[model samples]
Target: MQGPHSPAPPVDVQPASWRDLSSIRELEKLCFGRDAWPWIDTLAALTFPQTVRLKAVSDEFVVGFIFGDQRRLKRTGWIASIGVHPDYRRRGIGRTLLVACEDLLGMPRVRLSLRGSNDAALRLYQQAGYVRIDTWKRYYRDGEDAIIMEKVR
Candidate 1:
Protein backbone atom coordinates (compact mmCIF):
# COMPACT_ATOMS: atom_id res chain seq x y z
CA MET A 1 0.00 0.00 0.00
CA GLN A 2 1.13 3.56 -0.65
CA GLY A 3 2.08 5.48 2.49
CA PRO A 4 1.05 9.04 3.24
CA HIS A 5 3.37 11.57 1.67
CA SER A 6 6.07 12.83 3.95
CA PRO A 7 6.41 16.51 4.75
CA ALA A 8 8.94 18.50 2.78
CA PRO A 9 12.26 19.16 4.44
CA PRO A 10 12.27 22.24 6.64
CA VAL A 11 14.02 25.25 5.10
CA ASP A 12 17.19 26.34 6.86
CA VAL A 13 17.60 29.99 7.78
CA GLN A 14 21.17 31.26 8.01
CA PRO A 15 23.12 34.52 8.07
CA ALA A 16 23.49 36.06 4.64
CA SER A 17 26.74 37.67 3.51
CA TRP A 18 28.10 39.48 0.49
CA ARG A 19 28.54 36.04 -1.11
CA ASP A 20 24.75 35.88 -1.30
CA LEU A 21 24.25 39.21 -3.10
CA SER A 22 23.51 37.73 -6.51
CA SER A 23 21.04 35.15 -5.21
CA ILE A 24 19.34 37.73 -3.03
CA ARG A 25 19.04 40.10 -5.97
CA GLU A 26 17.40 37.43 -8.07
CA LEU A 27 14.99 36.57 -5.29
CA GLU A 28 14.13 40.27 -4.85
CA LYS A 29 13.37 40.60 -8.53
CA LEU A 30 11.24 37.48 -8.52
CA CYS A 31 9.29 38.45 -5.45
CA PHE A 32 8.96 42.22 -5.84
CA GLY A 33 9.03 42.70 -9.61
CA ARG A 34 9.38 46.42 -10.41
CA ASP A 35 9.54 47.22 -6.74
CA ALA A 36 12.62 45.08 -6.26
CA TRP A 37 15.63 46.83 -4.84
CA PRO A 38 18.37 47.76 -7.24
CA TRP A 39 21.61 45.80 -7.22
CA ILE A 40 23.39 48.49 -5.19
CA ASP A 41 20.75 48.43 -2.49
CA THR A 42 20.83 44.67 -2.35
CA LEU A 43 24.59 44.73 -2.12
CA ALA A 44 24.48 47.27 0.70
CA ALA A 45 21.95 45.19 2.61
CA LEU A 46 24.25 42.17 2.52
CA THR A 47 27.38 44.13 3.42
CA PHE A 48 26.20 46.87 5.75
CA PRO A 49 27.23 46.86 9.40
CA GLN A 50 24.52 46.88 12.11
CA THR A 51 22.25 45.05 9.74
CA VAL A 52 20.86 41.55 10.15
CA ARG A 53 20.60 39.64 6.92
CA LEU A 54 19.31 36.07 6.71
CA LYS A 55 18.51 33.63 3.94
CA ALA A 56 16.22 30.64 3.91
CA VAL A 57 17.81 27.79 2.03
CA SER A 58 15.88 24.82 0.72
CA ASP A 59 17.64 22.00 -1.06
CA GLU A 60 20.67 24.26 -1.28
CA PHE A 61 18.76 27.06 -2.96
CA VAL A 62 18.18 30.55 -1.62
CA VAL A 63 14.42 30.42 -1.36
CA GLY A 64 13.84 33.50 0.81
CA PHE A 65 15.73 36.34 2.45
CA ILE A 66 15.34 39.27 4.88
CA PHE A 67 17.29 42.38 5.88
CA GLY A 68 16.93 44.16 9.19
CA ASP A 69 18.58 47.43 10.19
CA GLN A 70 19.38 47.93 13.85
CA ARG A 71 19.34 51.41 15.35
CA ARG A 72 20.72 51.21 18.84
CA LEU A 73 19.98 54.83 19.74
CA LYS A 74 16.30 54.36 18.95
CA ARG A 75 16.26 50.76 20.10
CA THR A 76 14.36 49.87 16.94
CA GLY A 77 15.05 47.30 14.30
CA TRP A 78 13.63 47.95 10.87
CA ILE A 79 12.99 45.09 8.49
CA ALA A 80 14.12 46.72 5.27
CA SER A 81 13.02 43.94 3.00
CA ILE A 82 11.87 40.32 2.85
CA GLY A 83 10.93 38.11 -0.04
CA VAL A 84 10.37 34.51 -1.04
CA HIS A 85 10.53 33.08 -4.51
CA PRO A 86 7.00 32.64 -5.90
CA ASP A 87 7.36 28.87 -6.04
CA TYR A 88 8.39 28.86 -2.37
CA ARG A 89 5.68 31.14 -0.96
CA ARG A 90 3.16 29.94 1.64
CA ARG A 91 5.54 27.32 3.01
CA GLY A 92 6.61 29.41 6.02
CA ILE A 93 9.87 30.55 4.42
CA GLY A 94 8.99 34.21 4.83
CA ARG A 95 8.02 33.78 8.45
CA THR A 96 11.14 31.77 9.19
CA LEU A 97 13.44 34.41 7.73
CA LEU A 98 11.50 37.10 9.58
CA VAL A 99 11.86 35.40 12.94
CA ALA A 100 15.53 34.68 12.39
CA CYS A 101 16.25 38.29 11.50
CA GLU A 102 14.27 39.54 14.49
CA ASP A 103 16.21 37.29 16.85
CA LEU A 104 19.50 38.48 15.46
CA LEU A 105 18.48 42.15 15.63
CA GLY A 106 17.65 41.84 19.36
CA MET A 107 15.75 45.12 19.46
CA PRO A 108 12.95 46.20 21.78
CA ARG A 109 10.78 46.86 18.73
CA VAL A 110 10.83 45.77 15.09
CA ARG A 111 9.18 47.58 12.20
CA LEU A 112 8.48 47.04 8.51
CA SER A 113 6.63 48.68 5.67
CA LEU A 114 4.82 47.12 2.75
CA ARG A 115 2.55 48.14 -0.07
CA GLY A 116 -1.02 48.67 1.01
CA SER A 117 -2.14 46.37 -1.76
CA ASN A 118 -0.01 43.50 -0.50
CA ASP A 119 -2.69 41.66 1.42
CA ALA A 120 -0.76 38.42 1.71
CA ALA A 121 2.19 40.11 3.36
CA LEU A 122 -0.15 42.10 5.59
CA ARG A 123 -1.79 38.92 6.82
CA LEU A 124 1.52 37.24 7.41
CA TYR A 125 2.84 40.17 9.44
CA GLN A 126 -0.38 40.45 11.40
CA GLN A 127 -0.38 36.75 12.16
CA ALA A 128 3.19 37.07 13.37
CA GLY A 129 2.08 39.70 15.97
CA TYR A 130 2.70 42.97 14.10
CA VAL A 131 0.16 45.79 14.15
CA ARG A 132 -0.46 48.64 11.77
CA ILE A 133 1.16 51.78 13.17
CA ASP A 134 1.28 54.25 10.29
CA THR A 135 1.00 54.69 6.56
CA TRP A 136 3.06 56.67 4.08
CA LYS A 137 1.31 58.31 1.16
CA ARG A 138 2.76 57.75 -2.28
CA TYR A 139 5.45 55.67 -0.77
CA TYR A 140 6.20 53.65 -3.91
CA ARG A 141 7.20 54.84 -7.31
CA ASP A 142 3.80 53.79 -8.58
CA GLY A 143 2.04 55.73 -5.84
CA GLU A 144 0.96 52.82 -3.71
CA ASP A 145 0.69 53.80 -0.08
CA ALA A 146 3.02 52.01 2.27
CA ILE A 147 1.52 50.47 5.37
CA ILE A 148 3.94 50.61 8.25
CA MET A 149 3.71 47.99 10.95
CA GLU A 150 5.40 47.47 14.30
CA LYS A 151 5.99 44.67 16.77
CA VAL A 152 7.11 45.46 20.30
CA ARG A 153 8.46 42.84 22.66
Candidate 2:
Protein backbone atom coordinates (compact mmCIF):
# COMPACT_ATOMS: atom_id res chain seq x y z
CA MET A 1 0.00 0.00 0.00
CA GLN A 2 0.98 3.63 -0.48
CA GLY A 3 0.44 6.48 1.94
CA PRO A 4 -1.39 9.67 0.94
CA HIS A 5 1.80 11.69 1.26
CA SER A 6 3.93 9.14 -0.54
CA PRO A 7 5.67 10.37 -3.65
CA ALA A 8 4.00 9.68 -6.94
CA PRO A 9 5.27 6.65 -8.82
CA PRO A 10 8.46 7.33 -10.73
CA VAL A 11 8.26 7.83 -14.48
CA ASP A 12 10.73 5.88 -16.60
CA VAL A 13 12.52 7.70 -19.40
CA GLN A 14 14.12 5.51 -22.05
CA PRO A 15 15.23 5.51 -25.64
CA ALA A 16 12.28 5.07 -27.95
CA SER A 17 12.20 2.18 -30.37
CA TRP A 18 10.41 1.53 -33.65
CA ARG A 19 7.82 -0.38 -31.67
CA ASP A 20 6.70 2.89 -30.13
CA LEU A 21 5.94 4.60 -33.43
CA SER A 22 2.18 4.24 -33.18
CA SER A 23 2.04 5.53 -29.64
CA ILE A 24 4.28 8.46 -30.53
CA ARG A 25 2.23 9.27 -33.60
CA GLU A 26 -0.96 9.32 -31.57
CA LEU A 27 0.61 11.52 -28.93
CA GLU A 28 1.90 13.96 -31.53
CA LYS A 29 -1.57 14.30 -32.97
CA LEU A 30 -3.00 14.95 -29.56
CA CYS A 31 -0.41 17.52 -28.52
CA PHE A 32 0.35 19.17 -31.85
CA GLY A 33 -2.97 18.83 -33.62
CA ARG A 34 -2.46 20.07 -37.22
CA ASP A 35 1.27 20.37 -36.71
CA ALA A 36 1.78 16.69 -36.04
CA TRP A 37 4.44 15.02 -38.15
CA PRO A 38 3.56 12.55 -40.82
CA TRP A 39 3.94 8.87 -40.02
CA ILE A 40 7.14 8.57 -42.04
CA ASP A 41 8.83 11.36 -40.15
CA THR A 42 7.82 9.89 -36.80
CA LEU A 43 9.14 6.49 -37.85
CA ALA A 44 12.43 7.94 -39.03
CA ALA A 45 12.90 9.82 -35.79
CA LEU A 46 12.46 6.64 -33.83
CA THR A 47 14.82 4.50 -35.89
CA PHE A 48 17.55 6.99 -36.72
CA PRO A 49 20.55 6.13 -34.60
CA GLN A 50 21.93 9.67 -34.55
CA THR A 51 18.71 11.16 -33.30
CA VAL A 52 18.01 11.36 -29.58
CA ARG A 53 14.58 9.95 -28.86
CA LEU A 54 13.27 9.66 -25.34
CA LYS A 55 9.91 8.58 -24.04
CA ALA A 56 8.30 8.97 -20.66
CA VAL A 57 6.55 5.76 -19.81
CA SER A 58 4.43 4.64 -16.89
CA ASP A 59 3.08 1.11 -16.83
CA GLU A 60 4.49 0.61 -20.32
CA PHE A 61 2.41 3.40 -21.85
CA VAL A 62 4.11 6.38 -23.45
CA VAL A 63 2.93 9.57 -21.78
CA GLY A 64 5.39 12.00 -23.32
CA PHE A 65 8.12 12.02 -25.97
CA ILE A 66 10.99 14.18 -27.22
CA PHE A 67 13.46 13.99 -30.09
CA GLY A 68 16.76 15.83 -30.51
CA ASP A 69 19.19 16.03 -33.38
CA GLN A 70 22.77 16.99 -32.71
CA ARG A 71 25.13 18.82 -35.03
CA ARG A 72 28.50 18.35 -33.43
CA LEU A 73 30.36 20.30 -36.07
CA LYS A 74 28.11 23.29 -35.48
CA ARG A 75 28.04 22.83 -31.72
CA THR A 76 24.27 23.03 -31.68
CA GLY A 77 21.32 20.68 -31.32
CA TRP A 78 17.70 21.02 -32.31
CA ILE A 79 14.76 19.67 -30.39
CA ALA A 80 12.97 18.01 -33.29
CA SER A 81 9.73 17.40 -31.42
CA ILE A 82 8.12 17.21 -28.01
CA GLY A 83 4.67 16.19 -26.99
CA VAL A 84 2.83 15.10 -23.88
CA HIS A 85 -0.44 13.22 -23.83
CA PRO A 86 -3.33 15.49 -22.83
CA ASP A 87 -3.89 13.61 -19.61
CA TYR A 88 -0.21 13.99 -18.68
CA ARG A 89 0.29 17.71 -19.06
CA ARG A 90 1.20 20.01 -16.14
CA ARG A 91 2.89 17.13 -14.36
CA GLY A 92 6.53 17.86 -15.38
CA ILE A 93 6.52 15.03 -17.90
CA GLY A 94 7.38 17.32 -20.77
CA ARG A 95 10.12 19.01 -18.81
CA THR A 96 11.60 15.71 -17.80
CA LEU A 97 11.59 14.49 -21.39
CA LEU A 98 13.21 17.71 -22.60
CA VAL A 99 15.96 17.55 -20.01
CA ALA A 100 16.70 13.96 -20.84
CA CYS A 101 16.87 14.67 -24.55
CA GLU A 102 19.24 17.59 -23.98
CA ASP A 103 21.48 15.46 -21.85
CA LEU A 104 21.63 12.85 -24.56
CA LEU A 105 22.41 15.38 -27.26
CA GLY A 106 25.39 16.76 -25.30
CA MET A 107 25.60 19.90 -27.32
CA PRO A 108 26.78 23.34 -26.30
CA ARG A 109 23.39 24.83 -27.08
CA VAL A 110 19.94 23.40 -27.59
CA ARG A 111 17.37 25.09 -29.82
CA LEU A 112 13.66 24.66 -30.40
CA SER A 113 10.91 26.40 -32.31
CA LEU A 114 7.36 26.85 -31.10
CA ARG A 115 4.33 28.63 -32.44
CA GLY A 116 4.42 32.22 -31.31
CA SER A 117 0.80 32.01 -30.28
CA ASN A 118 1.27 29.01 -28.02
CA ASP A 119 1.36 30.69 -24.62
CA ALA A 120 1.46 27.51 -22.60
CA ALA A 121 4.45 26.08 -24.47
CA LEU A 122 6.20 29.45 -24.42
CA ARG A 123 5.77 29.65 -20.67
CA LEU A 124 7.15 26.14 -20.22
CA TYR A 125 10.24 26.90 -22.29
CA GLN A 126 10.83 30.23 -20.60
CA GLN A 127 10.59 28.64 -17.18
CA ALA A 128 13.10 26.06 -18.32
CA GLY A 129 15.64 28.87 -19.00
CA TYR A 130 15.13 29.12 -22.74
CA VAL A 131 15.43 32.65 -24.14
CA ARG A 132 13.78 33.88 -27.30
CA ILE A 133 16.50 34.38 -29.90
CA ASP A 134 14.64 35.08 -33.10
CA THR A 135 11.37 34.77 -34.99
CA TRP A 136 10.59 33.44 -38.43
CA LYS A 137 7.90 34.97 -40.57
CA ARG A 138 5.09 32.66 -41.65
CA TYR A 139 7.03 29.66 -40.41
CA TYR A 140 4.17 27.29 -39.91
CA ARG A 141 1.96 25.66 -42.54
CA ASP A 142 -0.92 27.67 -41.14
CA GLY A 143 1.19 30.84 -41.56
CA GLU A 144 1.74 31.42 -37.90
CA ASP A 145 5.14 32.87 -37.03
CA ALA A 146 7.56 30.68 -35.14
CA ILE A 147 9.52 31.90 -32.15
CA ILE A 148 12.96 30.34 -31.94
CA MET A 149 14.31 29.84 -28.48
CA GLU A 150 17.68 28.62 -27.22
CA LYS A 151 19.11 27.24 -24.01
CA VAL A 152 22.88 27.13 -23.62
CA ARG A 153 24.51 24.66 -21.31
Candidate 3:
Protein backbone atom coordinates (compact mmCIF):
# COMPACT_ATOMS: atom_id res chain seq x y z
CA MET A 1 0.00 0.00 0.00
CA GLN A 2 1.19 3.51 -0.83
CA GLY A 3 1.85 5.91 2.03
CA PRO A 4 2.49 9.63 2.39
CA HIS A 5 6.20 9.06 1.81
CA SER A 6 5.69 7.02 -1.32
CA PRO A 7 7.18 8.29 -4.53
CA ALA A 8 4.97 10.32 -6.78
CA PRO A 9 3.76 8.86 -10.05
CA PRO A 10 5.44 10.00 -13.22
CA VAL A 11 3.52 12.45 -15.43
CA ASP A 12 3.38 12.73 -19.19
CA VAL A 13 3.13 16.01 -21.01
CA GLN A 14 0.60 16.10 -23.83
CA PRO A 15 -1.02 18.56 -26.14
CA ALA A 16 -4.10 20.02 -24.49
CA SER A 17 -7.38 20.62 -26.29
CA TRP A 18 -10.80 22.03 -25.61
CA ARG A 19 -11.81 18.75 -24.01
CA ASP A 20 -9.46 19.51 -21.14
CA LEU A 21 -11.13 22.81 -20.26
CA SER A 22 -12.72 21.61 -17.04
CA SER A 23 -9.66 19.93 -15.61
CA ILE A 24 -7.38 22.77 -16.66
CA ARG A 25 -9.69 25.22 -14.98
CA GLU A 26 -9.59 23.15 -11.83
CA LEU A 27 -5.79 23.04 -11.89
CA GLU A 28 -5.58 26.75 -12.49
CA LYS A 29 -7.87 27.47 -9.56
CA LEU A 30 -5.73 25.35 -7.30
CA CYS A 31 -2.54 26.95 -8.51
CA PHE A 32 -3.53 30.59 -8.87
CA GLY A 33 -6.64 31.07 -6.75
CA ARG A 34 -8.02 34.57 -7.39
CA ASP A 35 -5.60 34.96 -10.29
CA ALA A 36 -7.00 32.03 -12.20
CA TRP A 37 -8.22 32.97 -15.60
CA PRO A 38 -11.92 32.86 -16.35
CA TRP A 39 -13.53 29.97 -18.18
CA ILE A 40 -13.84 32.01 -21.36
CA ASP A 41 -10.14 32.83 -21.36
CA THR A 42 -9.30 29.19 -20.76
CA LEU A 43 -11.52 28.21 -23.67
CA ALA A 44 -9.88 30.76 -25.89
CA ALA A 45 -6.42 29.43 -25.06
CA LEU A 46 -7.50 25.94 -25.98
CA THR A 47 -9.16 26.92 -29.24
CA PHE A 48 -7.04 29.78 -30.49
CA PRO A 49 -4.57 29.46 -33.33
CA GLN A 50 -0.94 30.47 -32.83
CA THR A 51 -1.22 29.19 -29.31
CA VAL A 52 0.51 26.19 -27.75
CA ARG A 53 -1.30 24.52 -24.90
CA LEU A 54 0.03 21.56 -22.94
CA LYS A 55 -1.01 19.52 -19.92
CA ALA A 56 0.70 17.17 -17.50
CA VAL A 57 -1.21 14.04 -16.66
CA SER A 58 -0.52 11.26 -14.21
CA ASP A 59 -2.78 8.25 -13.86
CA GLU A 60 -5.27 9.99 -16.11
CA PHE A 61 -5.50 13.07 -13.91
CA VAL A 62 -4.56 16.47 -15.23
CA VAL A 63 -1.93 17.82 -12.85
CA GLY A 64 -0.51 20.81 -14.66
CA PHE A 65 -1.03 23.09 -17.65
CA ILE A 66 0.73 25.74 -19.75
CA PHE A 67 -0.29 28.11 -22.52
CA GLY A 68 1.95 30.04 -24.90
CA ASP A 69 1.21 32.46 -27.70
CA GLN A 70 3.37 32.70 -30.81
CA ARG A 71 3.91 36.27 -31.86
CA ARG A 72 5.33 36.42 -35.35
CA LEU A 73 5.94 40.11 -35.17
CA LYS A 74 8.18 39.78 -32.16
CA ARG A 75 9.65 36.39 -32.96
CA THR A 76 8.86 35.63 -29.38
CA GLY A 77 6.57 33.18 -27.69
CA TRP A 78 4.62 34.62 -24.81
CA ILE A 79 3.99 32.17 -22.03
CA ALA A 80 0.59 33.39 -20.97
CA SER A 81 -0.08 31.00 -18.14
CA ILE A 82 1.42 28.01 -16.36
CA GLY A 83 0.21 26.20 -13.29
CA VAL A 84 0.79 22.96 -11.43
CA HIS A 85 -1.75 21.38 -9.11
CA PRO A 86 -0.64 21.95 -5.54
CA ASP A 87 -0.36 18.27 -4.79
CA TYR A 88 1.88 17.73 -7.82
CA ARG A 89 4.28 20.60 -7.32
CA ARG A 90 8.07 20.19 -6.84
CA ARG A 91 8.03 17.05 -8.94
CA GLY A 92 9.43 18.84 -12.02
CA ILE A 93 6.01 19.09 -13.71
CA GLY A 94 6.25 22.85 -14.14
CA ARG A 95 9.69 22.66 -15.66
CA THR A 96 8.64 19.90 -18.01
CA LEU A 97 5.60 21.83 -19.17
CA LEU A 98 7.70 24.94 -19.64
CA VAL A 99 10.33 23.20 -21.73
CA ALA A 100 7.69 21.49 -23.85
CA CYS A 101 5.77 24.70 -24.47
CA GLU A 102 8.95 26.54 -25.35
CA ASP A 103 9.98 23.85 -27.81
CA LEU A 104 6.60 23.83 -29.51
CA LEU A 105 6.39 27.59 -29.68
CA GLY A 106 9.39 27.64 -32.09
CA MET A 107 10.34 31.20 -31.30
CA PRO A 108 13.67 32.93 -30.89
CA ARG A 109 12.69 34.13 -27.44
CA VAL A 110 9.98 33.68 -24.82
CA ARG A 111 8.36 35.93 -22.26
CA LEU A 112 6.04 35.71 -19.28
CA SER A 113 4.80 37.74 -16.34
CA LEU A 114 4.13 36.80 -12.77
CA ARG A 115 3.08 38.52 -9.59
CA GLY A 116 6.07 40.16 -7.94
CA SER A 117 5.21 38.43 -4.71
CA ASN A 118 5.25 34.96 -6.29
CA ASP A 119 8.75 34.06 -5.22
CA ALA A 120 8.31 30.41 -6.12
CA ALA A 121 7.47 31.33 -9.69
CA LEU A 122 10.28 33.85 -9.75
CA ARG A 123 12.75 31.20 -8.73
CA LEU A 124 11.43 28.78 -11.29
CA TYR A 125 11.74 31.32 -14.06
CA GLN A 126 15.21 32.30 -12.99
CA GLN A 127 16.31 28.71 -12.82
CA ALA A 128 15.00 28.24 -16.33
CA GLY A 129 17.14 31.19 -17.50
CA TYR A 130 14.47 33.86 -17.63
CA VAL A 131 15.69 37.35 -16.81
CA ARG A 132 13.73 40.25 -15.42
CA ILE A 133 12.73 42.52 -18.28
CA ASP A 134 10.16 44.92 -16.92
CA THR A 135 7.52 45.51 -14.28
CA TRP A 136 3.92 46.62 -14.55
CA LYS A 137 2.60 48.27 -11.43
CA ARG A 138 -0.77 47.23 -10.10
CA TYR A 139 -1.06 44.79 -12.95
CA TYR A 140 -3.33 42.32 -11.25
CA ARG A 141 -6.93 42.59 -10.08
CA ASP A 142 -5.69 42.75 -6.51
CA GLY A 143 -3.11 45.42 -7.34
CA GLU A 144 -0.14 43.11 -7.23
CA ASP A 145 2.82 44.34 -9.24
CA ALA A 146 3.76 42.18 -12.25
CA ILE A 147 7.36 41.32 -13.02
CA ILE A 148 7.92 40.60 -16.66
CA MET A 149 10.51 37.95 -17.43
CA GLU A 150 12.06 36.86 -20.69
CA LYS A 151 14.37 34.17 -22.09
CA VAL A 152 16.22 34.76 -25.30
CA ARG A 153 17.60 31.95 -27.38
Candidate 4:
Protein backbone atom coordinates (compact mmCIF):
# COMPACT_ATOMS: atom_id res chain seq x y z
CA MET A 1 0.00 0.00 0.00
CA GLN A 2 1.32 3.42 -0.92
CA GLY A 3 1.56 5.69 2.07
CA PRO A 4 1.50 9.48 1.93
CA HIS A 5 5.05 9.94 0.67
CA SER A 6 4.92 7.75 -2.39
CA PRO A 7 5.30 9.29 -5.83
CA ALA A 8 2.40 8.73 -8.23
CA PRO A 9 2.94 5.17 -9.49
CA PRO A 10 4.07 6.12 -12.95
CA VAL A 11 6.40 8.93 -11.93
CA ASP A 12 10.12 8.24 -12.31
CA VAL A 13 12.48 10.25 -10.17
CA GLN A 14 16.09 10.54 -11.28
CA PRO A 15 19.18 12.58 -10.67
CA ALA A 16 19.23 15.76 -12.72
CA SER A 17 22.27 17.36 -14.30
CA TRP A 18 23.32 20.27 -16.45
CA ARG A 19 21.63 18.65 -19.45
CA ASP A 20 18.31 19.59 -17.90
CA LEU A 21 19.08 23.31 -17.87
CA SER A 22 16.50 24.37 -20.45
CA SER A 23 13.59 22.48 -18.96
CA ILE A 24 14.63 23.45 -15.47
CA ARG A 25 14.74 27.08 -16.47
CA GLU A 26 11.23 26.93 -17.87
CA LEU A 27 9.95 25.26 -14.73
CA GLU A 28 11.65 27.77 -12.47
CA LYS A 29 10.06 30.63 -14.34
CA LEU A 30 6.68 28.96 -14.20
CA CYS A 31 6.86 28.31 -10.48
CA PHE A 32 8.55 31.44 -9.19
CA GLY A 33 7.48 34.12 -11.62
CA ARG A 34 9.78 37.11 -11.03
CA ASP A 35 11.75 35.26 -8.41
CA ALA A 36 12.93 32.57 -10.77
CA TRP A 37 16.68 32.12 -10.71
CA PRO A 38 18.55 33.60 -13.61
CA TRP A 39 20.02 31.36 -16.27
CA ILE A 40 23.43 31.53 -14.67
CA ASP A 41 22.16 30.60 -11.26
CA THR A 42 20.11 27.75 -12.70
CA LEU A 43 23.15 26.48 -14.55
CA ALA A 44 25.27 26.64 -11.44
CA ALA A 45 22.72 24.76 -9.37
CA LEU A 46 22.82 21.83 -11.74
CA THR A 47 26.60 21.67 -12.02
CA PHE A 48 27.84 22.82 -8.64
CA PRO A 49 29.64 20.21 -6.60
CA GLN A 50 28.02 19.30 -3.27
CA THR A 51 24.60 20.09 -4.70
CA VAL A 52 21.93 17.41 -5.06
CA ARG A 53 19.60 17.92 -8.02
CA LEU A 54 16.77 15.70 -9.11
CA LYS A 55 14.07 15.70 -11.75
CA ALA A 56 10.68 14.03 -11.79
CA VAL A 57 9.82 12.50 -15.12
CA SER A 58 6.35 11.60 -16.32
CA ASP A 59 5.24 10.96 -19.88
CA GLU A 60 8.81 11.63 -20.97
CA PHE A 61 8.69 15.21 -19.72
CA VAL A 62 10.48 16.79 -16.82
CA VAL A 63 7.56 17.54 -14.58
CA GLY A 64 9.34 18.63 -11.41
CA PHE A 65 12.79 19.50 -10.12
CA ILE A 66 14.50 20.01 -6.77
CA PHE A 67 17.98 20.93 -5.67
CA GLY A 68 19.63 21.32 -2.30
CA ASP A 69 22.74 22.95 -0.92
CA GLN A 70 24.66 20.62 1.34
CA ARG A 71 27.00 21.99 3.95
CA ARG A 72 28.89 19.09 5.39
CA LEU A 73 30.70 21.31 7.85
CA LYS A 74 27.42 22.53 9.27
CA ARG A 75 25.75 19.13 8.94
CA THR A 76 22.79 20.90 7.42
CA GLY A 77 21.27 20.77 3.97
CA TRP A 78 19.35 23.68 2.58
CA ILE A 79 16.68 22.93 0.07
CA ALA A 80 17.85 25.59 -2.34
CA SER A 81 14.84 25.36 -4.64
CA ILE A 82 12.01 23.12 -5.78
CA GLY A 83 9.24 23.38 -8.35
CA VAL A 84 6.57 21.41 -10.17
CA HIS A 85 4.99 22.04 -13.55
CA PRO A 86 1.67 23.86 -13.01
CA ASP A 87 -0.32 20.97 -14.39
CA TYR A 88 1.65 18.57 -12.19
CA ARG A 89 1.29 20.05 -8.76
CA ARG A 90 -0.28 18.14 -5.85
CA ARG A 91 0.12 14.75 -7.46
CA GLY A 92 2.81 13.84 -4.85
CA ILE A 93 5.69 15.06 -7.02
CA GLY A 94 6.66 17.84 -4.65
CA ARG A 95 6.62 15.68 -1.56
CA THR A 96 8.39 12.80 -3.20
CA LEU A 97 11.08 15.06 -4.63
CA LEU A 98 11.53 16.65 -1.22
CA VAL A 99 11.93 13.35 0.56
CA ALA A 100 14.28 12.07 -2.08
CA CYS A 101 16.48 15.15 -1.84
CA GLU A 102 16.53 14.98 1.93
CA ASP A 103 17.78 11.41 1.77
CA LEU A 104 20.48 12.23 -0.73
CA LEU A 105 21.57 15.12 1.42
CA GLY A 106 21.99 12.69 4.31
CA MET A 107 22.30 15.43 6.82
CA PRO A 108 21.06 15.69 10.35
CA ARG A 109 18.77 18.58 9.42
CA VAL A 110 17.14 19.99 6.34
CA ARG A 111 15.92 23.55 5.89
CA LEU A 112 14.18 25.56 3.21
CA SER A 113 13.19 29.14 2.73
CA LEU A 114 10.00 30.13 0.97
CA ARG A 115 8.17 33.35 0.25
CA GLY A 116 5.75 34.14 3.07
CA SER A 117 2.71 34.14 0.83
CA ASN A 118 3.35 30.75 -0.76
CA ASP A 119 0.47 28.87 0.76
CA ALA A 120 0.89 25.70 -1.23
CA ALA A 121 4.56 25.45 -0.41
CA LEU A 122 3.87 26.13 3.24
CA ARG A 123 1.32 23.35 3.29
CA LEU A 124 3.66 20.89 1.61
CA TYR A 125 6.56 21.65 3.91
CA GLN A 126 4.42 21.53 7.01
CA GLN A 127 2.96 18.16 6.02
CA ALA A 128 6.53 16.97 5.61
CA GLY A 129 7.19 17.83 9.29
CA TYR A 130 9.06 21.08 8.91
CA VAL A 131 8.49 23.82 11.46
CA ARG A 132 9.07 27.50 10.96
CA ILE A 133 12.07 28.51 13.01
CA ASP A 134 12.73 31.95 11.68
CA THR A 135 11.74 34.58 9.15
CA TRP A 136 13.86 36.94 7.14
CA LYS A 137 12.35 40.32 6.43
CA ARG A 138 12.38 41.46 2.82
CA TYR A 139 14.22 38.34 1.77
CA TYR A 140 12.74 38.11 -1.69
CA ARG A 141 13.68 40.44 -4.53
CA ASP A 142 10.13 41.89 -4.46
CA GLY A 143 10.35 42.43 -0.67
CA GLU A 144 8.29 39.48 0.42
CA ASP A 145 9.42 37.93 3.70
CA ALA A 146 11.04 34.50 3.60
CA ILE A 147 9.80 31.90 6.02
CA ILE A 148 12.58 29.57 7.12
CA MET A 149 11.43 26.09 7.95
CA GLU A 150 13.50 23.15 9.19
CA LYS A 151 13.23 19.42 9.74
CA VAL A 152 15.58 17.79 12.24
CA ARG A 153 16.21 14.12 12.54
**lDDT per residue (tens digit) for residues 1-153 in model 4:** 769997565888999999999999999999988889889999999999999999999877999999999999999999999999998887999999999999999999999999899999999999999999999999988888999999997
Q: Which stretches of candidate 3 lie over 4 Å from their true place?
A: 1-6
- What range of 10 consecutive residues in model 3 has the weakest lDDT sum? 1-10
Report every candidate's CA lDDT.
0.91, 0.90, 0.94, 0.94
lDDT of 2 by residue, 24-64 (tens): 99899999888899999999999887799989997778989
lDDT value for model 3: 0.94
Cα lDDT of model 1 by residue, 118-142, tens digit: 9999999999999999999999999
Q: Runs in model 1 with CA error above 4 Å?
A: 1-6
**Model 3, residue 52: displacement in angstroms?**
0.4
Candidate 2 TM-score over all chains jointly: 0.93
A best-first ranking of the candidates according to their lDDT comes to 4, 3, 1, 2
RMSD of 4: 4.7
2 against 3, candidate with superior TM-score: 3
